[model samples]
Target: MASTTPQGLCIHPRQMDFELPDPLPRHWHGGDAFKSHLFDAMSLQFPDGERFFIDSVRYFREHIGDPQLRKQIRSFIGQEGHHSREHQVYSKRLRDLGYDIDRLEGHVQARIRFTQKRLSPQRQLAATAALEHITAIMAEGLLRDARHLEGAHPTMVRLWRWHALEETEHKAVAFDVYNQVCGNRSLLRRAMLMGTFFFVLDTSRGLVHMLKRDGLLWNWRVWRGGLSWLWGKRGIYRPLLGPYRDFFRDDFHPWQRDSLELLQRLRGEFDGAHQAEEANGPVPS
Candidate 1:
């Protein structure tokens, strides 16, 4: 099973009052419909998804005895709370753009409700840990690669980088909590399987919905280009395959990937900007 969280690790929330563009561009990522909708699909899932993550980790807060773990738990909750609120704003931007935000969210809400009602608390926590692993790897990918956000709008880029920074900060919190409360490798692996299925399914459904609205769903050129961008050599997600598969190992831990250097590098960039933002007063909403 996974070891305790890495030594000297600390988690804290950052306020990133992102003022997303009033009317978000339909093709915000380099004017590519597939790329923009893919990101939009994931953003639409965050408000509710972050809440579920918070509740799952909170359910086991009392079970943890380590002082540091408990402190990290509080910060984790705060960080995810910030993510949920910011993404709710992002979702509203999508709504204003005429995408069916309600319909996309309803499907995720129904699944969360069912999981809470039918699954055990341990299972719920396992799912949270599994999903966290997924996000953590993707966050690391975004941070390590400037190519991922190349040509994106500046404000949107800032918002995503802020999110990625925090995600990297608390990447291990849920995993540590799960390991403390229930160290069942079998359960975790199963959760990964189920969680990956729904994540892909929901993201694809939302992507399709937005593309259809934009009248690009049937455009073969868009699919051809997007698919190449995602799966071809040097693709944005191509590097993440190994990290994603590492979750199934018997001794897997989030820090085994050893991203502390990258984390510190970004902390300098984002923390400096955040301090400046505070000094400048709140961003005009």
Candidate 2:
């Protein structure tokens, strides 16, 4: 369902089998429980979270007037739809390993339910726009930083690389939709501020839950490594703070942060030959 756009962007989905065929190691990231669990904890949030993203965008899909963005909506939906399904299978891997993935997913799902029920349509779209910004930046970090996936299982690495690539491809769709339909700047900014807070809180809660379950809650090694991985010399989170704050700028848009070569490289590395050959313009090799 993925195709090239007029601008030469590959706007389609790459459907891959993210299967955990073996008994997965509890700590898959370079054998560090904290590092592995950090990403796995984040995985717990994706299935339902991505669904909410799809729904928020879908809610506004029919109303979009631009043909290019309208087409982009379909591609965005396709990409996210694949991400949700793949991550569902991916989450089950952690669930099978006794990480209590379902419990956290339930809490997150309930939170999404509350947002859907209580927030205005514009507010919901604004939230989606804000959260998409978070994911896009996070994806950028993962793609740009080799250490994020280094020492991880091959399957996991490929899966995440694929996700990062597609997230880059479609990062602007929801924001564009929000911009077209909603003109209230404060709603967008306010939602972004709250979204960042909750995103970190929820991710931490899930990671801590897994740590306690794995009986590594007090492990100083994991504590040290996890802190270092996120905040150390080559830490992923520190570099993102500036980009994260960029969301508050009034003229900000996803394209303002360019990483086109990153997109090309990841797609070339992970995409099947067929998918790659079909990419038009600047999106494919």
Candidate 3:
């Protein structure tokens, strides 16, 4: 039997560590606009998503009557709510820059309604877990590729970095929940659901929107850059994709291919910076 203790799901919310740059990058000008658009879309998507999941919890609690699972569901909802709020603030910054976020928001609402109508709670959770897994992998990949983004806008880079880090931190929660709730479900079915959600809904939507907004969708330069980044010498895609693909296997765990060593290294660097500040005494206000 799986453990239902709160300790099993304990997750620490780390403070945002990355610094946003002052001036934005040139290549990222339109991208930032798109991000603003995307963030608004996420704001719309997340609340509805959260409500659906919360309702799922309520449904399960009534049927299964597991108090521990109920608490876990609440924590998951809280984390997602925080994500929605943060992204909403970030989206407002984009709006302040004069982007039209309303249309983007409308599109998101439509998508959410479509998803709600089409999927069961189990499949919805499966999709969410898959997306979370992808996000986690992308987070680690971005950190590894931060140097490549050096010439990009600082604020955009910082936003992506912070988003990536948080994604990595909470990657396991949804999957764990999905596994716990969907008892006796085959891993193969879960894997197929995840792949379909990402490839069809998430990735395809992102690519189409990006292309329409930036005119870079079919551009060889953008394609080359993306491919190079994903498959290049220092590419993180290989390691990142491994665990996700293996998720269909009977032995899969959320942490199976985790970049734990890298995570630890980054944590050490963060701690060391704090120690250095302490050693130098408090700075003048």
Name the best candidate (by TM-score): 1
Q: TM-score for model 3?
A: 0.65
Candidate 1 residues lying further than 4 Å off, grouped into runs, are: 1-4, 273-285
lDDT of 1 by residue, 154-242 (tens): 98888888888889888999998998889899999999999999999999999999999999899999999899888889889999999
Residues 1-285 of candidate 2 have per-residue lDDT tens digits of 121222656676766776764577888887888888888877778889888988898898778888778777888888888888988887877778877777788888999999999999899989988999899999999998888888998888888888888898888888888888885679999999888888887889988998998889998888997898899887878999898888887777788788777777667786676877564322211
Candidate 2 segments whose C-alpha is farther than 4 A from its true place: 1-6, 277-285
Clashes of each: 0, 1, 1
Worst lDDT 10-window in candidate 2: 276-285
Expressed as tens digits, the lDDT of each residue in 120-178 for candidate 3 is: 77766666666666656667876777543455556665655555555565566566666
Total clashing pairs in model 2:
1
TM-score of 2: 0.92
Clashing pairs in 2: 2-12
